[model samples]
Target: MAEAVRHVQVIAAQCTAMGPLSQLEKAARELHDALTDPMLGGCQARTGEYPSLLIGDDLTPQDIDKAVDAVVRQAKADGAVLVLALLGHGFTPPQRTDLYFMVRNSTTQSLRSAVDVGRLITEAADEPGIDGVIAIVDTCHAAGGVPDAGRLAGGVRAGRSRLAILTAAAADQPARDMCLSLSLARTLKDGVPGAGPALYIDRTLAETLRDQVSGQVIGRAEYDQDPFPLEGLWLARNPSNIANAHADVVGPLGLQDLSQSVDMWRGPRRSPGRLTRSTLLELEKFISCGRVDDELDSASRAWVDDVVTALLEVFRTKEFLADVLAGSLTSDLLRSAGRLAGFPSRAEGTVPLRDLLEYAVLRAQPLDGAPWKGLARFVAALLHEAGISHVDPRLQEWARRLHLVTEVNDAFGEFAEARQRRALRLVVSLVGAWTEWPEEVDAWLLHGSADLPLHQRFPCEPGGAHGVAQAIGAAMMWARRELPHPELLEHVDIAAPAHLLARWYPEEEKVGRYLLGAKYSVIPRWSGRLDEAEDNAEINDAARKALKKMSSCAAAPVEWIDSDALLDRSALEYRLSTGQYDAAIGVDHSPDDLEEVLELLLPFAPIVLWPRSGTRPDQDQLRGLVQERWHELPDGLAAAYRHRWGAHQHCVACLGDIRTVWHDEGWLEFCRPFEYRVVTTPEEEA
Candidate 1:
């Protein structure tokens, strides 16, 4: 006995309450074309009041119901898989939660006259012998209409038949005009050509339709029963399916197809269009399941090459890189690729390591390169882990062209000033390969010399000046042991002094004096001159010891200057009284000396001192002096003196007092008379 062939039947209907001007008619035409297309193997009977199942303008509620009934009856008789596509305007009545599909004669006031979706599904479900049902709804708030339809259909089916529902939007979302319909039409057109034998809507096709309609109109699919039975049950043979069956033999050609599809739909910006979690999961599974063994045939080789090419394309995109950093789809793909690359334990794969290194090098090729530092850091670490003795040509070129050592020095300088510290950190991580590249290490030492304050010139591990100092010390140690270049070692030695100078001379300098004064001060206890021979011997011995220690580390020869003049109380007093402030303010005096000088000078001229260190004279003594002599000075001179040093009130008062004294006494009154008259020039004297 021969069995009868069961077929698939498609019934498409559109509501046109807005008449000929309505877009529902156009949506209806598109749905009808998609259904009856040869690829779908849909049966269209011409027995109804309308020639075909497409219900549009002039169709009343009664006519729609009759048409729907006839289509269902024919499909039931043939035991066919039935597909229902509804495109129309939908209505929600005031104070009502339910939605309705409006018929041509239906009015806003008489929504009950419209087709209730729940009732329509119940009618379809009552019919016997229908294999399965796929209802695609394109009306506004179509998802809101689905629960009722599913519930009503469940009662009629009594668990005997299968039902699947696809809606254009969620329950609360609206379906925009033409967007849902156009996407649906396009999805159906594309999906039907890939339907294998049995010709019924499957999960793949349903998901494909959902992906296609996203952003334009968000759609969802639900099934009343297991969906596995419906897969590949369509009547038409899909050529693409035949190709996919031999996917392993074709190698990675499917990836190329996927890449092309992504490019086509990704729009002008090449954005990550509608790449959903499901799509990524499917791709990952495909790659994982189709992975070949170590031995490669021509086809497998091609497959591996294409896979790498596709990944490179993905890595180049900003959107994809963001996903990679976020540990999203790209991360997953890389992990799977990594497993295939022979590292199954790592989450991020190593297959793309070489490609990423090359990409980073290319980006860093220009003089002012904009390399992705994070990627570069990863590549450097990976190479270091592999114990590579020599640098890759691409990496070497990047280092050579960009002068990465100089970049690190610049970043370190900015970091010392509390600016962009991350730049320094990134550069440090990227130069992990410097040990393998001797030229780069030498370059770093040479470039580091140009910046003053050693802390600002060397890479530190986030600690600060001390951290930088330690890093430089460690580098020096390494260079002495590992580096053979004499010049490089010399450069390192020179760098050590900059660090020492920074530590010792940390204060700001004005002229030859330090703002914070010298770190060590000499306290003179003797007021009288010592024996010349003993003093000279002692000073020379001390100078030699200091010079010996300094010469070893200093960049140039160290020299000590000698002076014959002795520092005594009388000379100090004379300099202070005469307003020779530089000599009076000792080279290494603390701020207290400035005060003592001002106190001594109060009895002499109205002196305003500008010392090398910019330290002001003692405030209290100056004020007391000014107060004591306030009544003796003219008002104009006192006011001028006060105004001149008013910023430091004590200095102003001292100036006022001194002006009173100087005005009353002559400028030379404090100078001593010459006691010794020269008799050597007796002839001139006579």
Candidate 2:
């Protein structure tokens, strides 16, 4: 009898509803083409070879059921490995909720909910030839958020077989649509072996072969049944990793297998005294970059040890001091060197005390003025290594005085504009209690002496001593009344309270009003009283509001563009929710005409042509429109559109509007309406 036919199904179901469609079809077509190309992952087998089947279909209740049944039947009949690629909706709602998948059904014209997916497990548990199952879920569960580990673990348990469930995101993380699958496609077309370095995975055939070599080890673990000769199995985010796993699992398929030859796959070249000085130099660079991972190869670990030894030797040398002062060496490496400076400072050494404070200063100077603030926290680690008490009065004072918290805040602001101030607040909260701070820091937040530049700064608004008093009072009341520790606020001085209560500053009020009217407001809650837990969140919301107002007011008004009638209002609103508007328009302009609308929306916009259908756009016309526009788009936008537009239907903000356009391009140009403010000078507007 012929062996079970190998099967691969890459489901590019972008639709969360059974209504109008666009990118779902495109993704399906792309998956279909990928499956047909044998050079991709489709391989011919020997002796009753298992044939491969690729399924690219929209996900619906009925569709999901059929898919489940088809996969189960194929697994039983072929006794072959199975691969399922799912790209759609999945996420955890607020308050640690269960993640859910959106399954659509067109006959009923509605979305179906698929919870605790069980097809693969049921078939593996029931069949004979089926080696194992590999399932990949690339979608947010709810509100574009990932479920927690507890939920994923529970889902795995529900499968009840030799099953492997892999998600694109961690349980508590949200998944994003493939950001550059087409650009990756072009790279793949150029014949790059394995999957290109794209943002997401979609090599269906390779995944199938990968399953063949790895066998049912993952599923066996799930079933609590380990068989003989354990096969290698892995969960990876990159396609190249899967390809590497494939070669590792198969192991010398033909005459290539030579018993006498050395095992290159066993890791590194085994040679006596392999730790050379040259290798040690390279190791120093890697460690300084914070590239140390627990998953390093044996050779790598040995090399790291050698480098650590060399670093220690350098620190002991007088010549190293000159280099440190000249800004040629890093403080982090210097600290590491300091730790290794003593005879016991080598990789295997046990140095009790090292001058890490000096090390931090040295490192900070060279790294463009302490570029990453997280490195400052290494001081604590150095102290711990030296066996110093973290709670020591001297240590706490030192920690607070480092100004590392502010440094970290600045770093976060550099990384993300929307969350900049909030990130700063979080850093302060996290590291405020450190010991090394001067009394002047708190004194600045209180009353300051006249003519003293630092003294004029206060924790609350300027010239609002009353506001500061009110904030202190409210913080104390809330701590005493609502929080877990009433004495907490008492312990916390007026320098930095857990929360603050102050009347909205005029500028702040203006920003908030503009945001309150915008479709995608930055403020999370409009009417709620500010409290301790909500303080940071409130700040972020206010900043977002202010930014929008400033952007909108600064842009010179163009009379030709009708602000109210620009682009489909619903589509524009959807675009706003996804942060797409910010990307395409900048803070300068809005898309009021078809050309601008098409320019911004076409790249990632999934066309929903409306006919006689209720909410869904007309099917045939929509398909034609998308097919026609697919190749006409600009290259950059096309790449971006293909990457982020798929699998956004049924999103909380989507509201099942079929004729909708969701723009997710990173248009950071358009001035936002909430950013508007009265300015005294043109320079201020500029």
Among the numbered candidates, top TM-score falls to 1
- Output the lDDT of residue 153, model 2: 39
Q: Give the CA lDDT, 0 to 100, for residue 309 in model 1.
A: 40
Candidate 2 Cα outliers beyond 4 Å, as residue runs: 1-5, 14-21, 43-59, 91-97, 105-112, 118-129, 142-166, 170-177, 180-686
The whole-model C-alpha lDDT of candidate 2 against the native structure comes to 0.31
RMSD of each: 35.7, 24.0
lDDT of 1 by residue, 1-686 (tens): 00111222233334445433355567666766665553433433232122344555655667667656655654564444566666676666676545577766776678667877656755664456566666767777776555454464456555455566667676556676645667656655554454532334456655666666654345544444422222222423233454432221211222323444444333223223223334445554554554445234445444444444433433333232343234432333433332222221211211133333333333223455444333333333333333332244544554454345334333334333321211111011112221121111111222323331122223454444344434544554543454334423321111111112212221212212322112211111110011112333333333344333322210111110001112354664564334333111112112324333333433322212221233343433333233233222222342443344345444523332231111111111111111122323224854
Q: lDDT per residue, candidate 2, 1-686, as tens digits?
A: 11112345555543435333344445444543553333443311111111122223444555655555555444444344455555555445456444455554322122234533333334434344455554545454322222223333345334222444544444455444331222223333343344432212234433432343221111111232223111212222234443442221112110011111113323333332122334445545654565445345545444444334423432332232333234434333443333322111111111111223222322323445543232334433433434444464654444355445554344333433422221111001111212322121111111112222111211432224344333333333333443233222112212221111111211122212231112111111111111123233433343344334322211110111123335355755464445332211211122223333433333221121111112333323233232223222221222222222346433322212212221111111111211243323324654
Give the least accurate 10-residue stretch of model 2, judged by summed lDDT: 422-431
